[model samples]
Target: MFYKYKCGNEIIRVFVWNDDFHNEVSVEDTKTQKSYDRTIREDENGKFFTWNRNTIYLNDWIKISMKELKEKIENGERITSDDLCQAIMTDGVENVRFIAPLNIRCGFGFFLNGNEFKDTLCKVEERWNREIKQNYKIVLIPVESDDSVANSADYYTEDFVSLIKCGNIKIAETQKLIHQEQSNEDYFEGVNDYFDGTMGV
Candidate 1:
């Protein structure tokens, strides 16, 4: 399922509000459709004619479960950008998190040290709450590298968790590796850091 999120360069997902209405009732009571005669009326001035005169507002995020969202994507009925904006405004989140997977081939990726990135991210988080809605800019913090390694290694997950706890990052959703038809590119313009001074693998 495809969930609509506020995305940026390093920011994976954030919240956005949506203002839409849901049609839950039908007018003209018939055997085919259920009747809403017993439903409580808020604005009593209006009465049902063809459909239930009651207007239902959907202000919060339209969270279709993973199963549901995927079905809609398959069916080509998924939500749009407008829908996502409405959802965030309606949900009203004080703070949000963004996370990404990391693997090191040469130099560290996204943040060289914990403190530098942490401090930058803290500024971003604050600015997000004060200024931007869906246009926040994410700085790509370079990761620190260890020269002792010879081959590439998966990034440490503990550091990721620590960043989250310290409010420098957030975990959104786990990514699934899906193979699809696509062109392949093998562009190696630079040397891998892992092979800098180490012997043959």
Candidate 2:
């Protein structure tokens, strides 16, 4: 399975598990197409070790069953997109937390970090509510299957626009559409449309 994340200007695409012989985790920068590989390590004692303490903890969090994850979410713990991505890799999509549209098929994808994306969605929803004063449903579409690590911005924007269009999320008034070029400093704001919304599942 694979997951995508937008961290600053870098689009991080993580291949959790693949048919590759090494069974290593492959992380790729969508923009540069540069990649790195990390694998679970074992110490001399025959005990498995994660890349580091943080990753070991992350792996533990990933091991939490979906039921537990939901409970944690209900208990007010924020699940980072990184956590979700790792969980999806470890547990598979069907077993991961969050809701997906019934129409979403096997290959459909979601943002890597659920909490961060949700916060962004909330911002868009608030903007719409303030401007339009009408409730609107936001739907997230999977990144196009053919989206490449190189030129991730294209597919990411396409998916974002598709979500808006698919849900009929329109601006209440014609305002200057600010287009900010992606940069290492603040890519999230650059992609902000001020008209996005969140999906129920």
Candidate 3:
């Protein structure tokens, strides 16, 4: 199942349900008015995934679509590691098991102008912990870079040790950092300590 969103000045679309499926569409430019396409696909074990043909601009205001917003909720097109894993397995040819690593990248920055990249790993991890068996070691791969989404020249970097790998260390650290960064004060002492507790880092 997939959803289409055309909110505000941006015409965003999401084709989710099965890992080999994803497409994010937006206008090329506010001035020129061209059409651009951004698509991302991957597998269950996190071995094989790719994002192809997407455009990005340095401008400020991100155009969003109201139609797209309504559709995402209606279709349940949120990105998750399980979604990636299912995509890999569902799309695999024959019995050819994809024996590669997993890359869990949260594209938090705006690939489209108005779209904010929200992280969904915390929820996905909880589900995976309960549902996924112990025979398989699911490596968490995070695409860490400015252009990890539509800007990478290659298939994008997939690191095995992410916040998931280190338990919730990164999460706690991120929370403290966010508070400090936003408030402009070192109010939280032992922030790193809290993160360390999660992973013994």
lDDT per residue, candidate 2, 1-201, as tens digits?
444544344444555542335546666645567777766555544422233222331132224333444455456676443433343334443222222222221223442322222111111211322211121222222222332111121113233334333343221211111222224336564445333442221
Lowest lDDT 10-residue stretch of candidate 1: 174-183
- lDDT for 129 in candidate 3 is 32
Selected candidate, larger TM-score, 1 vs 3: 1
lDDT scores in order: 0.29, 0.34, 0.31
Candidate 1 lDDT tens digits, 109-160? 4334322222111112223223223322232222333332221222223343
Ranking of predictions according to lDDT = 2, 3, 1
Question: Lowest summed-lDDT stretch of 10 residues in model 3?
Answer: 152-161
lDDT (tens digit, per residue) of candidate 3 on 1-201: 223334444543333323323343333343445544444333443322122333322111223232232243246555333333333233221211211222223447443432433232211121243222221333322334334333221111122113223332122122333454766544343565576684355
Q: Which predicted model would earn the best TM-score?
A: 2
Off by over 4 Å in 2: 1-62, 94-98, 101-201
The alpha-carbon lDDT assigned to residue 1 of candidate 3 equals 21
lDDT winner between 2 and 3, please give it.
2
lDDT leader: 2
Clashing pairs in model 2, backbone N/Cα/C closer than 3 A: 30-149, 81-112, 81-113, 99-201, 100-201
Q: What shift in Å separates residue 78 of candidate 3 from its native position after superposition?
A: 16
